[model samples]
Target: MKRAGPWLRVVAGSASFALPTILGIVILNFLFLQLLPGDAVDVLAMRSGSATVESISALRVQTGLDQPLSGQLAAYLSRLAHFDLGVSTQYHLPVADIIAARLPDTLLLVGGALGLAVVLGLLLGSVMASLAGRWIDRMLSGLLMLIYSTPGFWIGLMMILLFSVKLGLFPSAGSATIGTRLSGLAALYDKAAHLIMPMTALSLFYTAVYARLVRATMIDVLRQDFILAARAKGLHPVTLIRRHAIRNALIPVVTVAGIHLGNLLGGAVVVETVFGWPGMGRLAFDALLSRDFPVLLGVLLLSSILVVAVNALADVLLGWLDPRILTE
Candidate 1:
């Protein structure tokens, strides 16, 4: 209970900062969207191949697009204050509803990717650190560096080609098997099958990154005075690495993982596009192409909130890992 005090304080601090950060992101997203060359009506005009001036004018007026920029921003803020995200100009549906439908898939992808990266990275890092200067460490390091340098979308495409086309092991593109009503574990398994390729592709780069970081940090931790003392006291090499070096080394990895969680959303744009996964990243991509500002803004806003929340959780974890951080 006493140890939890600092953790609670850290969480409180994170929560306080999150609201303003999210608000700033929302405002910036709105401003950036406004700066785009055209609006949804223009996209509609292009798609229809023939929109009369009168009809275009009517559409603009009906959708409030004809309003002054300031008026539009103010109206958006007003709706936001009232907990409304407005309707999507392209889909003709509530932006919140559309985003809510897609958010879970995005969460699943990001969560799975993060979990896989952390676990695999830790294992690889430990091996490399323990076997430092060995042939296996050098070989693994080179392989990971190659993966780190590769583009995530290309990796995703190649995996799809191999696993789906050549091997017929997993579905090529989707979050689930379409046109199926399978429920229970069967449905879960189907989704997992679809998720494997994208998840691995998305996670590989981060896995390499984290592996390198952990290896470096763990090597340093193992050489510290405390580790030397422990070793002199007859501590087993495996126990020393596991109980002391890895725990200390993990602090930085956790910090970096928090930061990377936000970036995963950006990467998800490409991965989801390549995989045809129905998620917020794909929604935002489609919205961007269609000039659907409402939907895009909503997606950005929600994503920012999620990022903030994840970072806050990371802070709490950090405080638990090293309560000295809160004091500092």
Candidate 2:
């Protein structure tokens, strides 16, 4: 319990910082979106093809778009204070309901990708560090560089062509097959099969980055005085690497992963589109095209909260990994 003090303080600090940051993000997202030329009314008008002046005015008033910017902002803030995300102008459903339906898919994709990247990266990096200057290291280094340089969407497409089109091993698109109601393990397996390509595609770039970072950090850690001391104590090579070198090396990796959380979410926009996964990214894309401000703002707000929460968890993990961090 005594040792948990630092972690507790870290959590407290993160919460304090996160609240203001999220509020600021919400305001900025609202204001920035307002700068866009059209709103839901204009898009609805265009779609209807015969919208009249009076009808448009009525629609605006109904949607509260007739309110001044300040009034709209105030209303938005008030809604937020009550935890209301408002109704989607296009879908006419509560924005929260729509987001709740989609959020799980996005979380699954992002979480799976991040998990795969970290595990593969740590293994590959450890191997590279252990086999430094060998042909295997050189080969993997080149491959990592290639993967790092290539665009993720192209990788996803190629994967679809090979794994989905040619081999027919995995489904190319969609979160799950429609027109089928598979329950229990069958449903789980189906979802996993659908997820493989998107997860791999979303993860490859980050894997390459994390692998290279780990390789560098591990090599540096192996040369540190503490590592030398561990070696002098006649520790097993694997134990020394695992308990000393790799553990210390993970500090930077964790820090970078926390920072990359946002980028991972951003990348999901493209990956989700390519794979046709029904996630928040796809929803946001649709909302953008349809000028569904309520839905878009809700997505953005929720995404911001998720990023902040993940970052805070990362900080807590960091504190646990290195007690020195707590002291600092």
On lDDT, the candidate that comes out on top is 2
Clashes of 2: 0
TM-scores, all candidates, are: 0.97, 0.97
Question: Model 1 residue 276 lDDT?
Answer: 92
Over 1-328, each residue of candidate 1 has an lDDT whose tens digit, in order, gives 8767777778778988998888888888888788899899999999999899999999999999999988998999999999999999999999999999999999999999999999899999999999999999999999999999999999998998899999999999888877889999999999999899989989999999999999999999888999999999999999998899888778888899999988999999999999999999999999999999999999898888888888888887787778789887
TM-score of 1: 0.97
Number of the predicted model whose TM-score against the real structure is largest: 2
Segments in model 2 whose C-alpha atoms lie over 4 Å from true places: none
lDDT of candidates 1 onward, in order: 0.92, 0.93
Estimate the overall C-alpha local distance difference test score of candidate 1. Answer: 0.92
Runs off by more than 4 Å, candidate 1:
1-4
Candidate 2 RMSD to the correct structure: 1.1
The backbone clash count of each candidate, in order, is 0, 0
